[model samples]
Target: MKLQYWGTAAAEGLPAIFCRCETCQKARERGGKNIRTRPNAMIDGVLKIDFNADTYQQSMKYGVDLTDLKYLLVTHTHSDHFYPNDINMRRQGFANYCGNKTMLTVYGSDKVMASILPMAEAKSMAGLLQGVLVQPMEKVQIDKYTVYPVRGVHAAAAGPLVYAITDGEKTLLYCHDSGPLPDEVFAYWKENGLRFDYVSMDCTSGCSPMDYDAHMNLERNIAMRDRLLAEGLADGKTVFCCNHFSHNGAHSLYDEFVEIAAKEGFITSYDGMEVEI
Candidate 1:
């Protein structure tokens, strides 16, 4: 499987809309990787993690064939992660896109499902929507993969989720926009001795004064990595990565985060970053 990072910024994106913060200013000065959009990812060009607000820009930047996506797994209905209106483009007569009449299976909690269902209905996108699969805190098969949707400690009303996916051979933990692991999720990992080939965590605050609750910080990520390793849930071979940065944290702070994560055997994901498993 091939995984690509589409975007790597928190809600407002790096160099946020009209902020004059030093970090945002620096990001504007140092473009490239320092520049970030909303958070999203693509797996094998078929499975997409989220349909962010910046989906169009990400597609254009990476030349991603959006029509190739077969499944879309949504973590929550957060504006940065879910933008159902953009998905309407897949509807017939909406746009002349390439690729076959792709089927996109979206899985999420009830809140996310509710948010997307209306859009899918209005656009008459049943052919493309496939269905809204409500996620549970247990492993379930979707297409050819086993996906486990774990409850996350994010917005109480939004009903956030974190995912652990396995395509028979390799496992990937998509942990983002979430705080510390819930007890059941940790128990499952501990009892099963689960090890992920790739782990993408939420690192919204990079050594900033911002307190980490729903999202994590550099210290939290490092501590989480240590715990995963100590519990045999991670190995030296595991590719641990962090993403979803906030503009307040700044671009230079992200560089510092990358440096710190590198020392701890973690990769800092950026837009267009790809990994094959």
Candidate 2:
């Protein structure tokens, strides 16, 4: 399976729209991978993990053919991850392109469905927006691939979600906009005994204050990697990666953060980074 990183910034994005911090300033000055848009990824050009506010630009920048994508697996309803209005573009008479025969199917938790329904209803129900409310640990099939939505504790009121996908060959666990791995996730790992080929975790806090319940710092990120390894959920062959960075992280530039991550045998994901598992 092929995984492409479209964007790699947290909610605020790198060189955040309204910030003047030194890191943001430096990111602006550097203006390459340092200038991130928002977090989103596409797997094998068919399934997208998250559709953020920056989806348009991210897709354009990456030369992604959005219309052909088969699935959109949303992680959560966080503004940075889910933008209902953008998705409404798929509705007939809304966008320029003719619709695909197989409408892009979306999978997410109840909270995600709630956030999307209103806009979809407004767009006219023409099968343009199809969806399935994914349950925790329940495997759903999209073509030949299986998708699992693991409940995340990012938001207390609304249960946040993350994803794991496999094509019966390789599995990738996308853990973002989330803090520590929930117990249910560990239980699923134990019950399934599946070893993930790639694990991309949230490093929203960078190296700053640690908040394991809401986001992860560099230290906590490494700790999670260790625990996943110890639990046999992943092995050394796993491509451990970190992403979803906040401007507040200790590293002011992409290279600065990447240097440290590389030293620890971790890949610091940047916009346009591609991995084949």
Candidate 3:
């Protein structure tokens, strides 16, 4: 599996769209890793984790061919993660320039559908978006992969979902657009003998010491990472990646953030970063 981190910032992004804070300004001065867009990623170039406002820009920057994206697994209905209206760009008259077939299979919660349905209805996009309402513990089959929607602690605007994707060999746990993994999800992990080879955690906490009601800080992420290690859900073979940052965190510099997380055995993610499994 090839995991690509197209954008690693939280909703506002680094050098936030309209932010005037020192953190944003500092990022503006020091480019490169300091630059980040909304959180989004791709798996093996075939599956996408989430869609944000910067999806198109990220795709272009990373040279990603969206036409090959077969499955789109959404974690929530957050604007930074799920941009329903932008999905219409795949319609026949819109992006028909791609020579290959471009049907996208979408999986998410009911709230996700609510966001997509209106946009899909607005356009004549028929087969462009094949959406399936997913629930916790449901195993959805997409080609050679099996996807699981794990529960997480987060705001209930429309309810949130995290994903566990596997190809019968390796598993990747994408935990973001979420806070901590709920007790039920851990129980399911134990009950099903589930293990992850790759774990992309939410580090929105940045350098913060406390956890959010719907997000994780560095301390909470470390605790969660350690717990997963002890529970056998993660082992020496696991690739623990930390991403999805907010400017509110202690450090705005990517190198500084990576250094901090590295002390606790985490590889900080950056835009256009790709990890092979």
* Predicted candidate 2 versus true structure: per-residue lDDT over 1-277, tens digit per residue: 9999998899888988899999998988888889887889988888888898899988888887676667888888887888878887776666555544446778888888886666556546455667778887788898878877677758855557777788989999898778887677888877876789999999887768774488887787799899989999898899888899989889836878999888887889898999998
The reply for model 1, stretches above 4 Å from the true place, is: 96-100, 191-193, 209-212, 250-252
Candidate 3 per-residue lDDT, tens place, 1-277, comes to 8899989998888878898798888898888899999989988888888898899988898887776677888888888898876787877777774455656778888888876666555454665667878888887887887888776677787568888888888998899867777678888877877899998888886887763478887787888888899988999989888889988888746968888888888888999999986
Clashes of each: 0, 0, 0
The TM-score that candidate 1 achieves is: 0.91
Identify the leading candidate in terms of TM-score.
2
Could you tell me how far off, in angstroms, the CA of residue 123 lies in candidate 3 after the best superposition? Answer: 8.0
Query: Which residue pairs collide, candidate 1?
Result: none
Question: Could you tell me which residue pairs clash in candidate 3?
Answer: none
What's model 3's lDDT at 143? 82
Best-first order by TM-score? 2, 3, 1
Candidate 3 accuracy as TM-score: 0.93
